[model samples]
Target: MGHADTLLAMGGAFLAAAFFARLGNRIGLPTIPLFTLAGMLLGPHTPGFVLVEDAHDFEMLSALGLVLLLFYLGLEFHLDDLKTGGRRLALAGGSYLLLNVGAGFGFGLALDWGIREALVLAGVLGISSSAIVTKILIDLGRLGRPETRLILGVIVVEDVFLALYLAALQPVIGGAHGVAEVLFQVTKAFAFLLVLAATARYGTRLIGRLIHVRDDELLVISFLGAAVLVAGVSELLGVADAIGAFMVGLILAQTPSAARIRRLVHPLRDAFAAIFFFAFGLAIDPGDFAAVLVPVAVAATLTLLMNVAAGLIVARLYGYGPGPAADIAATLLARGEFALILAAMAATAGLDERLAPFIAGYVLVLAVLGPVAAGRAHLVVRRLTGGRTPDGPDDLAPVEAPERTTSA
Candidate 1:
């Protein structure tokens, strides 16, 4: 499609999501599921609607959205919680990642897939839905609760892990000859990230003086330019585009105008992000689900169980009583854009050809369950802990648990 036609199409998609987000909210369903279902309708799997026949452009924009989303995530990444929750964040996220990888690898083994496929499944499952979890906490206005704090910290840790793994996944899955070649690629990625982190700390001034995103049109173009450039750079350097986009986000986060930048980028991001979702619906082969509903249902149930359990346990470790902990657990039970994005990454990395369908099915389930999870969390906490109780002022003490990694 030409630029103008593509722009119009994208605009129409965004409006559709916004329209549906409200409609979903009114009808007691989550906004994300509505958009997702709409996307499925537009996909080639269904007849007569085919808004997205190819997904290359859609993935490109979705990657851009995830990078920015994480950048905003980083803006909130204060390391002060490193004392207590930080350690728990690391431990929990790492343990979960390890467990997920092992389980996924085991599944791969059972399925007789390649090592690459195994790792990809583990990576996809190890990661949870940051977007859904955070929104649940925020919407309930409990983001500051000690239990919520712990859960958020763990979620942040997962994001970091996902980012790192995503960066390495492309090379590892690409058949890079041997360990040394893989190590070299990893080192380059490490070096690249270190440089970007350093730049995020100190480089905004130079970019600001040069880029001058003062005008709305200029701002939007520059925003897209940064995403495209960083993604292209990562591609050139044999790193994942997600890594480059994230680095760009981190750098942008440090800018004085980041909040404003995010505001300006939201409409653009939301538009593409919607197309990205629609593209996923389009990408699903009708047959992937036709004969596999039972397995898909079982997989989704397992995912929900594992993710919620992790959330609750982490909340307890952070000193929350059992009630709030369960709420924290239930609150984070859904997966959306980021998780699916990673699944799509697995497709690009050629890890497991089977991953996309599994993950797509997984996302469809989680999207429908997100708000329900939040509601159940609220109910469980009230029933168990007697409602709206906080972990109290004592948690202001040391954050180290000696057992799990925590974050902020």
Candidate 2:
């Protein structure tokens, strides 16, 4: 095919994905699963329209997409939100982490997984999809709500844990020589982070000054360049590049140029994220999934139950009424991009390919159901709270209309 034809193929794939995604949302289901399914339909395993055989590059591009995702997330975050959300951020986030990780780890051990695999799965379970949750909160215009704010605060906590986990994983997965060497590695890793932190604080300003007078094009390349530089530094330090990318995000997070940077980068993020989902779907062998339906269903069901329980228990402990607690819990039940990323990592690290499809199938089911569960949960809450509004139990009367959108 000619260059234009190849570009057309890429364009057509995304258009189909977007069309199905919107179609899914119109019918009241969240579009997360449909996007993946859309990718699958356009991939090699389908009857026709396979467009992603050149998938090796998508991995890095997808990683870039996630880097932007986290960057945007940090743009809206602060260490201070932990203080503002009351004790709920720490309490609820902490409780949710402990219960979910502990339970997931225990289950992995029971299934005879290695320590590394168990720990990895535990970490994955502990971390929620901040993207999906944040998307829902924004879609609903509930970003300023107490529950929403608390969720973001907890998500920051989760990101901290993710950084630590991803960093510590190298040695835990046997990439180090000894305790002293591991200690040295950890030190080097953190020392590298310090340099990046310094760049965040200092480099951005100089670069901002340099590009201050230019058009937004410079902003686009400069921001992506910073992320790549930090990510390269992380690789040299023998650590996960994600930590470095995340640190870059933290630094650019609250800058005067942050909004401008986000506006410049979001198109690329969305485009590459579509390819990310497509590559993810390519990794799934549906035949493999169908053959082991029983075990897969069991694992998926367990995942759903555990996630919902974790969210609810934390909400209740933080003093939310049962209805709001349940609503928050239900909203958090789906695992999206992060889960796929982790599964890909696990496969590379030699932890059971079967686990990926099982988890993927679960994600597909929950992505469709989670929003309905959350929406209906609001109705249930209104009834229980006796016509109280979601944002404030006494501020406004109950709204019977579809007054919210929770697409992620």
Candidate 3:
């Protein structure tokens, strides 16, 4: 397409996203799914306006969206919060991965798609979309709630797991059989994470000085540069770009300019994030979903059950009631970008033909369902508990526990 046509298509996409999201808001629906639906309706995959002939046209913008989404999430997540729930976060995150990933692997094997296909499915169904979850929390106005901390913490944990998981899976999928090669990949990934963690823990002041500036415009440029640069470096190192951006945000969050950076980045994050989800929808061919409907249904059902069970377990670990448990489950139920990435990897590796469509359908189902479920979490819990809701404040407030003694 010509430059003018590209501009026009982008403009159409943005407007369509805004219109659908507005309509969703009127009906009390979350914007993430609506934005995706907008892309699907207008994309080349479907019979419609065809905003962009290829989703890859928006690939870089979509990547920026993902980076900004995670970056903002990290900015909101203070270092103090991480320190407070370190151990619980590890346990909760580990439990979530074990349940979802283990079940997903077993499900894939049951499909008889092959062991490598099962590995892809494990990651696809196991990891939640951090971008979608971040958007949902903001849109639902639940960012300040106590449960929100756990949700974000769990996502961070998941991202870390993803780094290690991808390293190990890449060799298997690529048909690399050497034990030394696999160990090297794993060690490289682990070392990268360690370096970033150390930086976040101790290099905040240096980073702060580097990015600090009198003008908001300059500061914005500085931080954006840092995020994108680090994301690029991460991708080169076989780590996910989103994690690098997130780590940058986490480190900057400790600086005095954290609030200003957050303020400046909010609008950018929202706009780019819309493009991210829209591009995701644009890539999906709804025609493929028909063949994988049964598998999608089964996978979706399994995901929902596993997520709820994991959420309840985490809630109990943290001494939260059913209400919080419901919230956690519903919020974490969405599988998205990571699933798509895995499907693409599988396709590239000549794995099972059915895997891509299954994942696409599964992500579509949960992306829409997850946000809806989160919105109705309170009502769902109330109904299940016979309409006896938890007492005042406890529903949204952090319960006073020994583990939560540190102040936010």
Candidate 4:
């Protein structure tokens, strides 16, 4: 496409996303699905008004969206929160992973796909989309709620698990025979995580000094450079780039400039994040959904059940009531970027042909459902629990509805 055409397409995509999101807002729906729906309708895969011939055109911007979303999450997260709830977070995260991943593995095996394909599906079905979760939290204005802290902690644990999971699965999918190669991959991934963790824990002062400046423009440039550079290195070192960006934010969170950085990054994060979801929809071909309908339905149902179970378990551990438990379940129910990543790996490795469509359908289902469920979780909990409200001082009762535009 010519430069003018590219501009027009990009402009049209933004406008369509805004229009759909505005409609969702009027009906009290979440923006994540609406933005995605806009892209799906306009994308080349669907009929009429193709916004872009290739979804790859938005790849870079979408990636930036993911990075910024996680980066802001890390910024909001603090060392003190981890210190106070370390053990609880560990247990909660562990229980969540055990239930979801174990069930997902069994479900994959039940599909009669190959062992390699099952392994891929295990990760795909297990991990929640950090990007979507972050957006929901922000949209619902639930950041101040006590359960939100636990949710973010769980996300951190999942990122760590993902690093090891990918390491173990890579050699299997790549047809590597050497035990040494497997050990090396695991060790390298673990080491990189440790290094970043240690930096977040101990090196804040130096990092703060490096990125600190008098001018907002220069400071923005410095922090953005740091985030993107570390994210690139993390990807090269066999870790997710989002984790790297998150780590950078974590490190900067301890600095004097933390609040300023957050202020500067919010607009960029919102714009890019809208693009991220839109681009995701663009890549999906609606025509393929029929091929994987049954499995997708079953998998999505299983995921909902397991997530709710895990949420109840975590709430019990934290001494929270059904309201918080429902919030936990609904918030973490969506699957996105990670599942797509695994599907791509499966396709590249020539695993089961059905894996891609299955994941695509599954993600699309939950991406819409997850946010809607989260929005109404309190009502669900109230109805189920005989009108007993959330118990904690920081429950969802205090979470005000965010402004309409904030959803994007």
Candidate 5:
């Protein structure tokens, strides 16, 4: 198709997705699934009503969207939490990741999907939607609740884990095989990450000094240029492009120019991120969704149960009572953009064809259900525990136990 035709197609897709987002907001549903569903409908694989004219162009744009999304996620990384949260945060967050990841892997094995696809599925099911969860916390006016604080700390831990996880996943996704080669690739990825981290830690002062452009236009261009350059280099080194972009974001997060960079890049991230989702749906055939729906339902149910249990364990470890514990669990239930990103990555890498649609359906289910469940967590907690909802000022407060709580 011609350039004008592609632009028109892109514009129409964005407008339709925007309308779906508005409609979701009106009905108190999450926007990610709405946007995904809209794309599926307009996609060539579905009724073929409205097609994106040039799939290759949209795919390139989608890749840029993924890089920007990862970069933004990196910028939001919370290093300060590691200091303030100390051991409690470590125990809670570590246990949460391991438990959920284990559950997902086991489920993948049950489906006989093999080790490679299982790993990818584990990641998709394990990572909570940081973007959606943050929005839920703010919208519900629960940002200051004690459990909410712990939840945010856990998300920071998840973010750190995901960055490293993506690094490790790169080699595996690149068709690395056998125990020795896999181990070697994993070691290389980790080594690269460690070297990058050390550089960021020691060279922060130098980076801070160099990013002192007074002109907003110059600063924005410089920041984006550096991010793209780093991402390109990372790909050249066999790491994923998103991983490279994330590292760049992490480096900038430490500099004084972090806020300025965030302010400028956020709008760009939002714009392209939507394209990423639309492009994902465009690649999926609607006919495949039904075949995956059963697994999606099963996986969603398992994640819901596991996340709640994990949240309660974390909350109780931090000395929170029943009510706040429920809040923490519900808040962690969201799974949206990151899951889609993983599915897209897997698709691009040519993993199991079934994995993509399964992920899309699974995310769609949870993205819609998570917010509603979180909003009603108090009632759920009360019903489950056979106790009235706490209404006092101290109800949402974070309390520490007299003794340190250890992970089970």
Candidate 6:
């Protein structure tokens, strides 16, 4: 197709996604899943007028969306919060990761898949979609809530674990025989992350001086260029671009320019994020999902229960009330990009073709349902327990809405 045609198609898709988001808002629902549903309907595999013919192009835009999304999340999150959370945060995050990974691994083994395939499934099912989580937090105005900090901290821990897991898995699965080669690859991954941490800790002032400008335009350009540059370098060094982008935001978060940087990047992030969700939907073929639907549904149900168990454990450790705990559980139920990436890697490495479609289906169902569940968690719990909130004796009192802070 011509450039004009491509641009028009992309533009139309964006508008449609926005419309769907608005529609979801009117219907008292989350927007991300709606956008993804819109993409599925307009996708090539579905019987409809496909707006995006070349998924590759939309994929690029989607990648940018992820970078911006993670970057924005980092701006909101802080290492200090995790530090202050201390042992509770560590225990909560660690236990949650262990439970999910264990569940996925056991599920794979139960299905009689080999160890390697089980490891792949474990990675897919274990990590929550940070993009989806961040959006829900912002949309619901829950970012500043106490439990939200724990949630973000746990997510950061999960991302770090995922990086290390992928690094080690790639070498092992690729048949790097020697202990030295595997150690070398794992060391490289940690070293890269260590450098990012150091920079975030010590180099913030330098970055501030270099990129902080009175001119908003120059500041935006400078910050954006740095984020993109770091992301590209991270990709070259065998880390995910979103991690690099997030590290940049972490460093900037320490500086005085964080609010401005956030303001400048907000529109870009939202715009590209919509495209990303749509592009994600575009790649999914409805036919491919059918064969794996039953197994995927069963696995998803198991994980959902596991997620609730994990969330409650973490919430109790951190001293959250039942209401907040339920919110954490519902939010953590989502699985997306990271899972999709692992599934794709499994396919690329020929570890398992069946893994990808099952993952696609599973993630689709949960990602859509998770946000809705989170938004209505209080109501669900109330209804389940005979129309009373879960806060012990106070359950009889009318459940008040959570206080939404002005800060994103």
Top-TM-score candidate index: 5
Q: Write the per-residue lDDT of candidate 1 for residues 24-83, one digit (tens) a residue.
A: 777666555567677666666778756666656576566665555554455444334345
193-310 per-residue lDDT for model 4 (tens digits): 6788799889988888988899999999998998999889977775667777877887898999998999899988877778877876786788887888999999999999999999
lDDT of 3 by residue, 195-238 (tens): 88788889988888888899999999999999999889876775
**Model 3 weakest 10-residue run by lDDT:** 399-408
- Model 6 weakest lDDT span, ten residues long: 399-408
* Candidate 6 local lDDT, 208-308, one digit each (tens): 78877899999888888888898888766656667778788878888889889888898888888778778767766778777787889888898888889
In candidate 6, how many Å is residue 223 off?
Answer: 1.5
Score candidate 4 by lDDT: 0.78
Candidate lDDT scores, in order, read 0.64, 0.65, 0.78, 0.78, 0.80, 0.75
Clashes of 1: 14
RMSD of candidates 1 onward, in order: 4.5, 4.8, 4.3, 4.6, 4.2, 4.4
- Model 3 residue 286 lDDT score: 74
Q: Candidate 2 on 1-408: residue-level lDDT in tens?
A: 567766776687678778977897678655556667776676666676677654453566556655665455444554445555566557777777787678767766766657667766676555666667666666566655556645665676676677767777755554567789988887887777677667666676765565443578778788788777777777677876667777776677546776676667667666766666766776666767785576546655666677667767766655556655765676676567666666766766667666777667867776666666766777766777798644434453322111111124
Give the lowest summed-lDDT range of ten residues in model 2.
398-407
Cα displacement (Å) at residue 48, model 4: 1.4
TM-score of each: 0.83, 0.83, 0.83, 0.81, 0.93, 0.83
Winning candidate number (lDDT): 5
Better of 4 and 5 by TM-score: 5
